[model samples]
Target: MTNFQQSEALSRVQPSTTLAVTQKARELKAAGRDIISLGAGEPDFDTPDFIKDAAIQAIRDGKTKYTAVDGIPELKQAVATKFKRDNNLDYDLDQISIAPGGKAILYNALVATMNPGDEVIIPAPYWVSYPDMALLAGGKPVIVKADASNGFKLSPEALEAVITPKTKWLIFNSPSNPTGAAYTHNEIKALTDVLLRYPHVMVMSDDMYEHIVYDGFEFATPAEVEPALYDRTLTVNGASKAFAMTGWRIGFAGGPKPMIKAMAKVMSQSTSNPSSISQWASVAALNGDQSFLKERNDAFKERRDLVVSMLNQANGLTCATPEGAFYVYPSCEGVIGKATPNGVKISSDEDFAAALLEDEGVAIVFGAAFGLSPYFRVSYAAAIEQLEDACQRIQRFCASLT
Candidate 1:
């Protein structure tokens, strides 16, 4: 018998809870269970046809061979244009990095820059990957809990209190995963103001859901709000959420030349360039007519409202309507300490989630998995009818708890 031990770095991180929950739902559905999964953060929309055409054209043009380790020149130029047009930010070709996906882009940046004992500040309830990724890169994760009272957004005072001399990075996300809370321009400016005091902390702004705002809500990024922090900020966006291109696996970042070069070097040694076909498709995604975004956003807003309203009606659940993204974080505190019809005690969010899945066949990610508690996240990215059914099931389950 051979004893195999996990590496110290690999052992430090847990699997992504979101992906795990999504997979569990898939398994349950495959086993003949009628499961309505709201665990995935992916959009329910299909990738636009024009973008798909570009990928097909690329294949016909024999663009299958590997090119630059980071990105192709055409895609880089397109990304540059996107930054200028959408974000009012400027970046030269050398200051851009393209990777397999947004997750890869972020992980590459962390691997390129993180040193042992360096601190990466992340706000809770954050995307599940942030803290784990930091731990994997030999960096310490410093989590700051953003309260629901403030719409689950990080306050400048709270952010200022968490900063220490060893802090090297702040992983910031707007239209955040798990919570879907987007910050206004002035709100972001307040946090950027605090960052101005700390020259050493780099900002990794995940603007993956930049175009998913609702109700005339304007989206703002750290670099866009504060020009002084531009050099230290990596503005990351991808075709996943807004463009419904999750399977395309294309993510790009614009930042300081040194950071970009470092990320490219990391890519060169690891995944090399992203899929050549995907890169071409992303160029079209960035440069093509964006009229479809408005239509899709209108649909997302409807689903958001429906889910929020229905969840609020649940006996023990109170869901907050988010500014953007497709998730609703509902506090299940009222259900905690209660007993299910099966007599199982719902002492925590995890218990509540498991019980809901077992009893009602509705899958949702629990808050503790996202560094918060007494709450759970429901992704309303499904079809409206499915969302209605899931919400109804959730209400029935909540009402049954006593």
Candidate 2:
């Protein structure tokens, strides 16, 4: 085999630990064993019929040709309208950039804006891709821990402590990946209050799960809550979680005109505008009536309740009732240092996950992968029956430990 010298930027990167367990679960499932997975990050629901019909119509109308580098005017207009109607923040067409997905849009922004040695502040238990993307873009990721004690919400004091002259971006995700933690309007305003003190620090708010909230919790964004930061904030969102369109490969963001132009420039050379058909479908998602969102969200809330309650009932597991998203980050501290019935020692969340997967065919991601410890993230994206079955297996596995 020929030895190759990878780029310095790539040398600093690591494969997504989250996807590693997910792939392991897939391998087991492919082998014909019954595996109930709680590792998924996306909604289990199918893409709405209206959005699918729009894609079909786009294909039939021969709109498959290459389009603009930034985004088609029609889709951008729809996104603008979405921001106005949902977040009450008005964005013009020129202020938006569309990409293959939320992750791609975020990477594009980092690549387009980050200079070498720039520091991007990221909270711990963040999405697996954020720090890696920043490193790939030649920026430094300065992580600040957000403990479970605070419901995984970042405090203004923590935000203030991290800012420096080199600080360039603050990456924020609401209804977060592993924790399903949503920041209230007041909590966000508190952080934004600190942000006002640092003019050099810009914000990238990832609102991918904005519609999956529960307990009458309304969603809020940086631009909407703190209008002053609106000029520097990149509000990124997509239909992947909200409209169950993960495979559609469409995500969009709105920000300052200069930042939007830089991001579009990167997109122009790289993955020129998102897929034409996907963009058309996104337009339908944004402009169409959103009554279906509530129905899907109700289903998600029910599943969340079922999974969270069942997991809490499991021995050695204490799950916090997440107010949004379809995930439960449960503390497994009680099981640590315990020995399995099979004589293997469960010293960490990873060990517990492996044992559970092998013994009970229940797949879960360890919380250490998300930068926390003694915890595991359980996705309730499966059906009610499957979720119940997984929880039963989990309880049994928990009981197997002594």
Candidate 3:
């Protein structure tokens, strides 16, 4: 067999560890192994019937032709309305752009702006795609760790410390993947205050988890909080997580017109305006009933609390309560240097994740994968019963350590 080589640009990035864990669990389950996967970040709910009907109607109407390079006018208007109605931000259609997914929207923007020596500041325990996308776009990722102690949220002081002449972008994700760490209004204000001083640095705010908050936490985006920084911030959102439309492949953002135009230019050469049907469905999703978001979030919050409590109860584990999102970042430091019943020593968080999976058939992403150490992420997006069983398996695995 001949070996196929990947490009140097592609080699700079690693495969998504969360998807890797999910795939491994799927493989084991296919082999008749009782595997429980907590690695998936997508919600466990179906798309609302109304949104599905929109797509069906679109297809029936023969609205499947190619649309605008960035997005159809109807979808762009809907996206603009969503931003204004929800985030209190004003973005004209020229300032709106759509892509196949949030991943595409982010990577394309980075590619459109980044130079070889450009730097993007990324808070650690971030969404898996941020740093890798920056690297793939020829920018250096400056990862500043936001550990469990601070709710896995980055500090204003940390943000200030990372800025340099070469700093080009700040990739921010609220209610972050792997850690459901949502920033409070005051917390976000502090960071924006720091950004006001760094005119050279732009912000890419990933508000994908804005609707998944708990405890009546008021969500705030960077641009909405600081008007002065508005021109430099890209407020990114999609129908994926909040609307339970992960497979729909529609992500849109509102930003400076220049940047939006540049991103659209890149999109024209690449994916060229996400699927037409998905765009129609997204227009419905953006403009339709948001009341259902609260109902789904209520379920997510319940699952989050359950997983947090159970993980905290596990021996050698300590899970911090998150304000929003359906994931937990738990520390496995106490279990380090310990040994399993089979005499395999636990060291890094990666070791703990592997042993737990091999011994108890539980799958989770390791902390190192998210640029941290001695911790792992658990996406509590599964059903209540499955989550309970997974937690019990995790507890049992921890107890087996000698």
Candidate 3 matches the true fold with a TM-score of: 0.98
Q: Which stretches of model 2 miss by more than 4 angstroms?
A: none
Residue-level lDDT tens digits of model 1 in 340-379 = 9999999999999999999999999999999999999999
Query: Model 3, range 1-402, lDDT digits (tens) per residue?
Result: 389998999999999988899999999999999999999989989999999999999999999999999999999999999999989999999999999988889988999999999999999977888888999999899999888767788999888998999999998899788788888778989999998888999999999898999998999999988889999999999989999999998888999999999999998888887999999999999889899999988898889889989999999999899888888999999999999999999989999999999999999999999988899999888999999999999999999998
Off by over 4 Å in 1: none
TM-score per prediction, in order, is 0.99, 0.98, 0.98
Each prediction's RMSD over C-alphas, in Å, is 0.8, 1.1, 1.0
For model 2, residues 108-211, the per-residue Cα lDDT tens digits are 99999999999999998888888899999999999999988899888888889989999999999998987899999999999999999888899999999898
> For residue 20, what is the lDDT in candidate 2?
82
Question: Backbone clashes in each candidate structure, one number apiece?
Answer: 0, 0, 0
Q: Which runs of model 3 end up more than 4 angstroms from their true locations? A: 1-3
lDDT of each: 0.95, 0.90, 0.92
Q: Please report how far candidate 2 places residue 230 from its true position, in Å.
A: 0.8
Once model 3 is optimally superposed onto the true structure by TM-score, how far is the C-alpha of residue 398 displaced, in angstroms? Answer: 0.6
